[model samples]
Target: MTDKYVIPREKIKQLESLLNERDIDTLLIFSREGSDPILPFLIGEDTIHLGAALFNKNGRHIMLTSKSDEKKYYESGIFSKVKTYNTSMAEVFLKELNEINPGKLALNFSLEDAIGDGLSVGLYMMLEELITKDRLQKIEVSGEEIIRELCSVKTQTEVDCLRRCIQITNDIYDEVFTKVKCGMSEKEIGDLFVEGMKKRDVINGLGKPYDYPIVCIVRAGLAHRSPGDTKTIPGDIVIMDFSVRSEGYVSDIARTAYFLKPGETEPPTDIQHAFHTAYKAITAAINEIGPGKRGYEVDAVGRKVIEDGGFPTVRHSVGHPIGRQCHDSGTALRPLKENQDNRAAERKIQLMETYAIEPTVIQDGGLPCMLVEENVVIREYGAEILSRRQEKLYLITCE
Candidate 1:
């Protein structure tokens, strides 16, 4: 069977209905340089360096682009109606808008969601100049509901890409474990990991030249400091956090190893205890994860475990959705409860959502630091761990 991009057509229909329910007659997405990820979802192609996508409640779709990109847009086979313009394209854009004659237009700009903020402040100012203040005044603008629906639901193609991303990430972790040695510099290990990924021909959805692989975190010291020129010494807790991208989908994983010498003392009891506690917390959270549960509730499972075990809770969210972007946009699994902070109000874990269940435990006064991360898809039963190498602790013996 030919692989397909899985955004559900029904979901798109639902989004259209949502716009109508909110009294929005049309949704307008503006972009420059094809820098925005949202444009691909609406227009089906990312070639337009500067363009706008308009979706009307009447089920009509229109895309406007620069004349230079008209040929590419036509060949893309994504947009239905394409309009091209030159230096004076403002007139072309306005003319298209006049055809729609929307009573209410929705623009992708929101304080709550970053995906909706694709239109830069400068671009917004330029757009305001193109249309009269009177015309703008008549349009009602908002973002709360629009962004929520656009990103929350996963299309089949997106889910498939994410699944493949997870498998590739797991394979890379295995490769790293095999090549790791006690004396290798942190950079050497990082370089090897990147090389392994390239050998596999893994390409990110957001292709580079502009985008680069993120070394999520690399620490080799008492405090998990950034990776430096220092060689990996026996008894050091070497932590490496890395990710690989596939078709815009991202997979994140973190692993820590201990180098032990013949005479070196074993890992500190406190440090060992903290690692086990954090691992148990992660497992417990995964057990409790499933459809119909709040994201914060699952987060608390991991947080309370670390606190009760005498370690500081992790500073970041337990996990986030994986999609077109590495930190694909969606709800986060977090520890802070709704009553404790307003941010929790935004943490609602929904079904068919993919997340990274990463739990970190730090010793009192920040002693032996450790972080464990894994990707999982939220299903009816619970979270399905994507990365197969979930070691409680990796013991590396010196050669």
Candidate 2:
């Protein structure tokens, strides 16, 4: 547990405003403790969802939970009401819902939206049964939109948390490069990073920002290699994707380290070119950042950097906003992809939004994928880099 911080009041107010604008009475969510970003974010403390929590348009909040958790929920100070389910969970939820009797409710009902955004189907089904067909008709699958908007931008408190995490991350990398040698295994290097954070109580998000999937990798070698027991060669590259959170705010950044053979100080010609290209893409993307720039346009700026440089672009978004979790949900700057509904990138970037501008480049003939990631916040006039930008590959030279 970290120092107690105020519940993100501004963010909650923003959600309340959205409710008034959309004519929805409440935003209902269902998730266990620490699993849902919105819950911990608005509550400002780790919250346990015994069943569901409801946020009214007036900014009042109530959590429906079992009697076991009722006491704990009240202590959180985030929710104005803590109602416990006495009978079945559904009965308890129905009683609480009746108390509020919101005219219209916004929920993440669609299968994809629920899966992507997380929803408690048990509570959702309970509401369906109690609200009757007419009342259920008023429920809309706009919770994802509400969730997206509420989490898209960072508050001053949230930003401060991220800055702290980034500082810790940079310092860890500084220690890592000095101690890491050519013979170290990728897994070993990654374990060092993990241990460093663990010692400090900094928790890494095992999954993407929104819990889409958990990919914990410490990539080594220039050949799309996942961190394995394989010993690192003299010329092997180190590109690790790590997301660690401090006080529930996550910092997502990656650095490319270079390990040259004995007496070799300089990186290979091709590797240097590719590394610089990746850095250039990140810079170009930052240059394109500002209030009102669409996520896609910003993404194109970075994508063009690699493509014009005769390299293939990354498969995912160039950069996405980070907070509370890795790949944290909010806004995004992603390429326009066919078939999938990628709406975040189409919207305009806003001020106070912190994002990870990571552009990966793959050289012709499939050299190791060159990746450079930095956490940045978009300001009114420009953007500010939260994480130290990887200007040069981290070099481990045995001179």
User: Best by TM-score, which number?
Assistant: 2
What TM value does model 2 have? 0.85
Provide the global lDDT of candidate 2 against the true structure: 0.72
Q: What is the per-residue lDDT of model 2 for residues 15-85, given as tens digits with 9 covering 90 to 100?
A: 78888998889888776655554566666555454557788888688887777777766766667888776
Off by over 4 Å in 1: 1-23, 47-50, 203-226, 263-269, 335-345, 364-366, 389-391
lDDT string for model 1 (1-399, tens) is 112223434445656787878878888777877666576665455644668777777766677887777775565454468898777669888998888888898877777677877777776777788777678668848654676656665655666777788788777777777887878776677677667777888753334522333322224243434345667766667666766777656777777667776675566686688678878888888887777777778877888888888777777777667666667667667755544654532556666677777777754432676777887776667777767746567777786
Task: State the C-alpha lDDT per candidate.
Answer: 0.68, 0.72
Considering every candidate listed, which one attains the maximal lDDT? 2
Cα distance off (Å), candidate 1, residue 4: 8.4
Estimated TM-score for each candidate: 0.83, 0.85
